[model samples]
Target: MSDSRVNLGKQHPAAYKALIALSAEVEEAAVTAGLDPLLVELLRMRTSQINGCAFCLRMHTRDALKKGENPDRIAVLPAWEETGCFSETDRAALRLTEAVTRVPDGHVPDTEYDAAAAVLTADQISAVAWPATVMNAFNRVAITSPYPVGG
Candidate 1:
C-alpha cells in the first residue's frame, strides 16, 4: 500500500469516459423506471459499504442525506433485515445489490433474482442491477487506486 497506484480512469481516458457515459445512461434508465432518488442513493451506499469502498460510501452517504434519506436507515443498512424501516421494494433492491456485489463469494443465485423479480418489475430489476454492476466496477477502480477521501 506504500506505492502509489495508477489512476485507471486517467491512464485510459477513453475507458473512463465510456464508463461515465454508461453510468449516465443507466441512471436515466433507473429514474425512468421510477426508482426513488433516495432509494437509489441508498442502494448505491449499501453496495459501496459491502464492497468496503470508503470513497463510494462517503460520497453516496452524503448524497443520500442530501436527497432526504433517513439517517437511521443509513446507520442500519448492514442489518437491514432486522429493521422494518424499508419497504418491500427497497428490501428487494438491497438484496439484489448484495447478491450482485458479492458475486465472487457465490454467483448471483436464481433465488435472489427471483425474490427481486417478485417485488420489482423487469425494468426496475434491470435498473437496480445495472447500478450495482457499475458500482462494483467503479469500486474496484477506486480501491485499486486507493482513492483518498476528505479534503
Candidate 2:
C-alpha cells in the first residue's frame, strides 16, 4: 500500500461542479430565507469542524471573518452551548448543523429538530439544512481526497 490518493474533484469534475452549483443555490436560498451571511458561514464552519474537514474549516472561517464575524465567536464555536456568545438564532442554527453533521449519531432526532423549529421559521430551517447537507458532501470529498492543508 502507498500513501497516495486521487483528488476527487479533479478526477470527477462533473460531480464536483454539480456540488458547487448546489452550494451556490443553497447560498441564495439561505439569503432569501433571511439567514445572515455570517451565520451561514458559521454553519459551514461548524459542519466542517464536526466532519474534521480542515480545508473547509479554514475556508469558511476566513469567509466568516471577512464578513465581520467576531473572532471570539469562532474561537468559542465548538463549545457554543457553554458560552453566552451566541444569539438564540445562532444557537438554533448551530444545533441544527451539528445534528445534520452527526446524523449517524441518532439520525437527526426529534429533539434536535424541535429545538431548531423552536427558534427557526420553516424557510429558515430548510435554509440551514441545505448548508449542512452540502457541507457534509464537501467534507467527504475533501477528507477522502485528503485535500492538502498548509500554513
Candidate 3:
C-alpha cells in the first residue's frame, strides 16, 4: 500500500472542525471591534489574493460583495496603490494588510502602522488584525494541503 497521507478534509475531521470554530471566533471579534465588515472582507480578499489562496479569495470576494463593496473596487484591489477607488481608511487598512501579510522582509514599518492607527481606533486595529491573521492562517492551510483550485 502507498504511504501518502490523505488530505485534511478527508483525513482530519476534528482539526477541520477546530478551524471552523476558530474562524467563527475571528469573525465575532471583527464585528465586536466595530470594524466595517465590508472593509474586513476586502482585506481578507486582498491578502488571499496576495498569497494566491484560491479558496479564501473565492470565499471573501463573495462576502465582500454581499456587504455592498463596489465591484469596481474589488476588480482593482491588486492595484490599490494606483487607484482612487478606495477611501483613506481603506488605503490605510490595505497598507496594514500588506505589511502583515508580507512581514519577514522587515518589521511592519512605522509609517504604515501609524497611517493605519490614525484612521482606525484601537479596537478597529484589533479587528483588522484578526482578519489578517485569519487569512494568513487559511493561506498556509490551503498552500500546504495543495487544495485544488478549479472543479
Candidate 4:
C-alpha cells in the first residue's frame, strides 16, 4: 500500500457527494433520452476502459452484464469502431463516449460531435455527453486515488 495515497472520494466527502448527485441526474437524463440501460452501462464501461480505470471497468462491466449487454460486445468494445456487433445507435454513442473520455486528444473534435449529432437526437446527444463527462471525472478520481479493484 502506498502510504501517501488517499481515497479521493473518502477524503473529499462533499465532492464525492456532488458527483453522486450528478450521477443520478445523468442517469435520469439518459433514461429520459430513451437510451437503453445497457447502452448506458456500456458507455460507462468503455470510458473506464479508455481511462485505464480498473475499478470502474469492473463495476460497469458487471452492471452491463446485469443489464443484459451481450458478452461479445463487452469483449470487443475496445475495438467498437471495427465491429458490426453494435447497432448504429451504439456506434454513435460509443464514438462520442470515447471522444469525450479522451478530451486531451483534441478537446473533443468537432467531427466527433457532428457524428453524434447526425445520428442522435439533440437530447440524446446531451445525455451521452454528460455521462461521458461525469465518467471522465470519476475516472480521474479513481486513477489518482489508486482505488483498489477486484476481491
Q: Give the top-scoring candidate (lDDT).
A: 2
Residue 73 in candidate 3, Cα distance off native in Å: 1.0
Predicted structure 1: lDDT: 0.90
Evaluation by TM-score, superior candidate among 2 and 4? 2
The CA lDDT of each predicted structure is 0.90, 0.94, 0.83, 0.91
Give residue 100's lDDT in candidate 4 (0 to 100). Answer: 86
TM-score of each: 0.94, 0.96, 0.86, 0.95
Candidates sorted by lDDT, best first: 2, 4, 1, 3
Candidate 4: regions farther than 4 A off: none
Candidate 2 Cα RMSD after full superposition onto the native fold (Å): 1.4
Tell me which residue pairs clash in candidate 1: none
Ten residues in sequence with the least summed lDDT for candidate 4: 142-151
Q: Which digits, one per residue and each the tens of the lDDT, describe model 2 over residues 7-114? A: 889999999999999999999999999999999999999999998899999999999999999999999999999999989999999999999999888889899999
- Model 4 per-residue lDDT tens digits across residues 71-147: 99999999988888999899999999988888888888999989989999999999999999999899889988958
Better of 3 and 4 by TM-score: 4
Q: What ranking of all candidate models by TM-score puts the best one first?
A: 2, 4, 1, 3
lDDT of 3 at 109: 88
Best by TM-score: 2
In candidate 2, how many Å is residue 32 off? 0.6
Tens digits of per-residue lDDT, candidate 1, 29-113, equal 9999988878888888888899899998999889888878889999999899999999999999999999999999888999999
| Error in Å for residue 21 of model 1 | 1.7
Between prediction 2 and prediction 4, which has the larger lDDT? 2
